[model samples]
Target: MSTPTDAAPAQPGVRKAGEDLLTVTDLHVYYGNIAAVKGVSLSVKQGEIVTLIGSNGAGKSTTLRTISGLLRPRTGTVVFDGKSLVGIPGHKVVGHGICQSPEGRRIFPKMTVEENLELGAFLRNDKAGIAADKERVLDLFPRLKERIAQKAGTMSGGEQQMLAVGRALMGSPKLLLLDEPSMGLAPVLVDLIFDTIRTIRDQGTTVLVVEQNALAALRIGDYAYVLESGHLKQEGVARELLKDDSIVKAYLGG
Candidate 1:
C-alpha cells in the first residue's frame, strides 16, 4: 500500500560508505502482479567493489535492471552521483555513466565482437575516448582481443562472458553493474572474471555486481548485501561477512 514517496530508510551498515556513487532506496519492482523486489535499499560508493549475493530469483537481476532503467521501480528512488535516475531510460542511464553487463550475456549474437563493443558506446560522441576504451577492454580481456572479429554467437560461454564485460567497459561507465558475471563458467574462468572485476574497480570505475558465488564475491567485494526473496536481509563489510561462516551458510549457501 506504500507509495513511491515513502522512501525506505538507509541500511545500517552503509554509514561508512564513502561518497555514494549510486543509491537505491525502497525499490519495489514487479512483474505483472508479482512483486519481484521488495523494499531493497543499497548504496555503491565511488571506486568500491560492492556485491549483491543471494540465491536465484532473489531480485538480484531485477535490482540491476531497475538501476539500468530496463525495469522501472514501482516505488523507490535511484540516485546516481546526486542526479535522480528514476525516470531515465536505459540508454540515457548509460549516458549518465552507468552500464550493465546483464545476465545471459545479451550480446548481439550475429554481430562480430568488435561491432558489439562499438554498440556499447553508441550513446557517446568522443571518438578518441571510445577508441581508447575499446583498447582498454581488449587489454582487460585478451581472449576478447584474440577473437575481436568473430561473431559473438560462435564464442564459447567463457569467451562470450568476457565479451559482455568488455563491451560494457566501452560505454565508459563510472558505475558498472554486473549481473552474474561468473555464471556458467569453468572454475578457472570464474577466478579470471573475478580478478578482472577487481582490476576494473582499481581502474577508477565503481562496480556493483550481482553474484551467486558468495565466497568469490565476498573475497573481492569491499561491501556486500545479502538479498533474500527480494528483501535485503543482511549487509556489512565484505571481509567481515566472508569470515562469518554462519552468515554465509545460512543466507548465501556458501
Candidate 2:
C-alpha cells in the first residue's frame, strides 16, 4: 500500500480545473465474514458531480465508508490529490479536505442545528472563514437558518436531510462525499436535494454522491459509475448513461 502524506494544500471549497481530486483503485472491503465491496474502482475530477448509484446492499455505502477512512479496505488504495489515504483515520481524512455526510443524515441528534454545523468545522481555527461558511449553509437551506437553535433530532426528515448537507458544506470541503443524501423523502423534497447538489458542484466543490435514486443521480451527475452486488458494472458520462438501454432497464425503471 502507498503511504499517505499531508502534502496537498487545502483549497477550502474550491476546485482546480483538470485535476483528479480523488481516486480509488481495486477496492475490496469486508465486514469480517461478509465481502461488502469487491474490486471497485472510480475517480472524481475537480469540480464534477460523480455519483455512485446502486440499489440496497450493492456496496455503495461501503465504498464511501472506505474512502472516508471509516472502514479499512481489505485491498485497495484511496488517493486524494497526491497523497495516499490507505490507513488514515476518519478524522485525519477530514483534515485532508474530504468531508463525508454519511448515510442516515447522522446529525448530532442532541445538539442544536447550529452546534452540529459548527462541529463540522472543528478541525479549523479560522473563525472568519468558519463564520462565512455557516452563513453560506444557511443561505442554501433557509429552513436550517430558521431552525438554527432547534435540536437536530427534532427536525422533520426532509429538514434533517438538508441540515446534513449543510453541515458538510460548513467544512468548506474541497472534495465532498455525500452518502444517500435523499434516501427517504417526498418527491418534491427529493427534487430540491438533487437541485442543491448540482448547485454545490457549480460553486466549485467536487462531489462524490452515493445514491439509490439512479435516475436523479444520473441527471445531476457529470460522470457516473453503477455498482451491483459489490462490483462495478458500468461507468460513463452521466447523460450518456441515462440514454443507455441496459442502465435504464436495470436501475432506472425505464
Candidate 3:
C-alpha cells in the first residue's frame, strides 16, 4: 500500500491533474469487535467537493475517522497525496493538511470563540499566517466575529457549526473533511452552511463532505458515493446519483 509519504508531486499528464487528493481502497475498520466500515473505497480529487451520503449509522462517520486517523482501520489503504495514511496519528494528519470538522460540532464549550479558533493553529508556527487565516475565517462568517468573546457553548447551534468550520480552516488544511455540517439547523442556516462549504472549495481546498441532507449534498457535490452497512453501494457523478430513482425515493425524499 503506497502512503502519502511516498507520494510524488503532481506530474504532468502522468494520470491527470487533481485526481485523488485522498484515496481509500478496501478500507476496513472496527469498533472493538464490531466492524463499522467494511472494504470501503473512495476518492477525493483536488479542489473538488465529494460527498458521502447515507442514513445515520451507515459508517459515514467511521470512514471519516479512519481517514483522519481517529480510528485505525483493521485493513485497507489510505493514500493521500501519494503516501499511505494508515498509521499516521490523528494530530499528525492535520499537519499533513487534512483536518476534520467532526460531527456534533464539538467545539470547546468553555472556551471563547476566538480562543477555540486559536487552538486550531496551535501546531502551526507561522504567526503572521495564523493571523491572516483568522481574519479570513472571521470574514467568511461574520457571526463568529460578533461572538468572538462569547463562550462557544452559549452560541446558537448554527453559530457553533460555523465556528467548527472556521476552526478547521484555521489549520490551513489542503483537504477538509466535514461531517454533517447541516445537521440540526433551521432551513436558512442549512442553506448558509452549504454556501460556506462552496466558498471553502472555491478558495482552493479539496473537500470530502459527509452529509445526511442527501438532496442538498448531491446538488452541491462534484462527485458522490452512497454507502450502506459500511459497504460501497453506489458511486457516480453527484447529478447522476440525484436523478437515480431509488436514490431519489429513498434518500432525497422525492
Candidate 4:
C-alpha cells in the first residue's frame, strides 16, 4: 500500500479548468439484494464545503461509505484528485488522501485519546509532520488536549465527536468525508461541530459531508444535495436550497 510519503500530487493531469476536486459518476452500492445508493453522481470543488442532506433511508451515508472505500460500488467511478478510486482498499483510500469521520463516532473504545490519533497517522512516516498535525488538531479542539490520556469511550459525547474529527485530521486528508457529524449531539455541541467543519474547509481541505441536520449543514456549506429514497431530489447552491420552498418545507420543517 502506498504511504502518505507517496502522496500523489494534490491534483494532476485531470481537467484543470473546473473547480472539481472530486467527482462521482453513476455511483451505485448494493447490500445483497438491495441497492442503497442508486446511480448517484456529484462533484466537489477544491476547498469547498459540500453537503449531502436527506432524511433517513435516503442513501446519504451509503454514498459516503462507497466513496471512502468501506463498501465497493456495484457500478460507477469515484475520481479524487484526478485518480480513479474504483478499486482501492479502505486503508489505501486514506493513502490516496481521502479520510472519513464515520457515522456514530466510531472511535477506539479501549484506546487513549492519543493512541487513537496515532492510529490515524499509521500511514505516514514523517513523525515530525504527524506530531505537528496532532498539535494543530488539539489547538482546534482544546478540550481534546486536556483529555489526551483519557479513554476515548469514557469521554462526553461532544468530546468523542471532537476526537473523531481530530483523528481524521491527523492524516492531513486532501478530501475529507464526514458522515452525520451531528447525529446525536446537543444543539450547542452541534454548533461547535459545524463551526469546526467550516474551519477545516477554511484551512483548504475539500469536504463532502452527509448530515441529517439539513438546515445547519446547508447554512455553512457552499453547495448542497437533497436525497430521498436512494435518489437525488434536489441540488443547488446552499443558500438557494435554503430558500427553495419545496426544500424548506420538506426537509427544513417548513
Model 4 segments more than 4 A misplaced: 1-17
CA lDDT scores, all candidates in order: 0.89, 0.89, 0.89, 0.87
Give model 2's TM-score versus the native structure: 0.92
Q: How close is candidate 4 to the true structure, as a TM-score?
A: 0.92
Total clashes in model 3, counting residue pairs 3 or more apart in sequence or in different chains: 5
What clash pairs does model 3 have?
3-83, 3-84, 4-83, 4-84, 7-82
Give the lDDT of residue 162 in candidate 1.
Answer: 92
Supply the global lDDT for candidate 1: 0.89
Going through the candidates in order, what is the number of backbone clashes in each?
Answer: 0, 0, 5, 0
Taking the tens digit of each residue's C-alpha lDDT, what string does model 1 give over 56-160?
899999999999999999999999999999989887899899989999889999999999999999988999999999989999999898898999999999999
What TM-score, over all chains together, does every model reach? 0.92, 0.92, 0.92, 0.92
> Model 2: per-residue lDDT, tens digit, 74-186?
99999998899999988899999999899999999999999999999989999999999998889889999999999999999999999999988888999999999988899
lDDT of 4 by residue, 103-190 (tens): 9989998999999999989899998999899998998999999999999999998899999998998888998889999989999999
Backbone clashes in model 4, listed as residue pairs: none
Q: In model 1, which runs have C-alpha deviations exceeding 4 angstroms?
A: 1-17, 251-254
